[model samples]
Target: MIQVVLLGSGNVATHLYQAFQKTSEVEVIQVFTRNQSLDFPSTIQVHSYNQLIPADVYIISVTDLAIAEVSKSIPFENQLVVHTSGTSALDVLDTKNRRGVFYPLQTFSKVKKVDFSEIPLCLETEFEEDYAIIEKMALSISKVVQSVSSDQRKALHVAAVFSCNFVNHLYQIGSEICEENNIPFSILFPLIKETAAKIETLTPIEAQTGPAIRRDEKTISKHLDFLQDKNQKEIYQLLTQSIQNVKKL
Candidate 1:
């Protein structure tokens, strides 16, 4: 079994711990957190860096800013240490130990249980030998594992923000508009699902619709006039122009 130590109490850490439990090939031997955590069993929870045990891999799944700090605190050297950050470079980890990245390309929420097999695991390592170890661990839980470089990971993270985070914010805005107009937000569920489903078979440019794509100025003006929120109006105008600009390409 591949012994593992997870060093964070956040969503990624929690979900990773759960996923590892279901696989017989990997075992999360211990978890190190800054505070006493309710997520993992207390028996394996260590709050001090000195209490960390020897493991095949140590995953620092903390905030990007704290990754270096946590890595430096580890009392050992020359062991494999990786971080679960999509945007952070592999060098962010302290050089005392072997450095690597095990970024899962998905938005994690504590409330939502994700299928580990479906999530893409982006792996990178400073040493070529370390890649096989990381890949073996990744393949234990996920089918989609790829060796992504730092530059490629950065670009992938930005694209994910645009596709997932920004789109979710627009859904919130749509929900608020529906609520204010006394319409059921659930009514948009089918449309939202269909919009997402279209991209599976059609490129976004080919699937594009709405007044902005058609250059219907009257409809665009009607939307801008209907929206009372200044921020919403600005966002609508900006997105409308952005759509037209893309169409010109």
Candidate 2:
């Protein structure tokens, strides 16, 4: 069995711990966290950062800013250490230990139950030998495993922010507009799902439709005029212009 000591008690850390618990080939030796009230299996031992125990692998699932600080605090040397970050480079970990990244390319929420097997695991290692160990752990929980370099991972992270984070923000804006008109946001759910489903078989450009793509000046102007909030109006104009620009290419 692969032994692991997981650091942090946030969404990623908690999800990893729960996923690892269900895998027969992995054992979480201990979990280190600053939040004493964080919930976990009663069978598992939880400790603070200063009381970290020895394990075959130490997984740092802390915030991006805290990654370096947390990894540097680990007293061990030359041991396999990995962080769950998308944008941060693998070298952010102290050179005292073997460094790597175990980035799961999916949004995680504490209240949401995630299907580990469906999440894509992006792996990177400073040393070649460490890759297999991390890959094995990844495969134990997930079916989709990929080897991503630091540079490539950074690029992927930027794309993800645009695709996932930005798109979600747009959804929030849509909901806000719907609420303002006494329209149930649920009315748009089917269109939203259908639009997303179309991308499964068609490129985003091919899937593109509506007034923005068609460059219907009248419709675009109507939308801008309807939006009272300056921020919303600005976003709508910017995105509409972006769509027109893409079509021009």
lDDT of each: 0.95, 0.91
Q: Where in model 2 is the C-alpha error above 4 Å?
A: none
Q: Write the per-residue lDDT of candidate 1 for residues 1-249, one digit (tens) a residue.
A: 889999999999999999999898899999998899888999999999999999999999999999999999999999999999988998999999999999999999988999999899999999999999989999999999999999999999999999999999999999999999999999999999999999999999999999999999999999999999999999999999999999742
TM-score of each: 0.98, 0.96
- Model 1 worst lDDT window (10 residues): 240-249
Reference-based lDDT, residue 50, model 2 = 63
Each candidate's clash count: 0, 0
How high a TM-score does candidate 1 get? 0.98
Clash pairs of candidate 1? none
* Top lDDT hit: 1
- Where is the poorest 10-residue window by lDDT in model 2? 37-46
Write the residue-wise lDDT of candidate 2 on 73-189 in tens digits: 997888999999999999999999999999999999999999999999999998889999999999999999999999999999999999999999999999999999999999999
Off by over 4 Å in 1: none
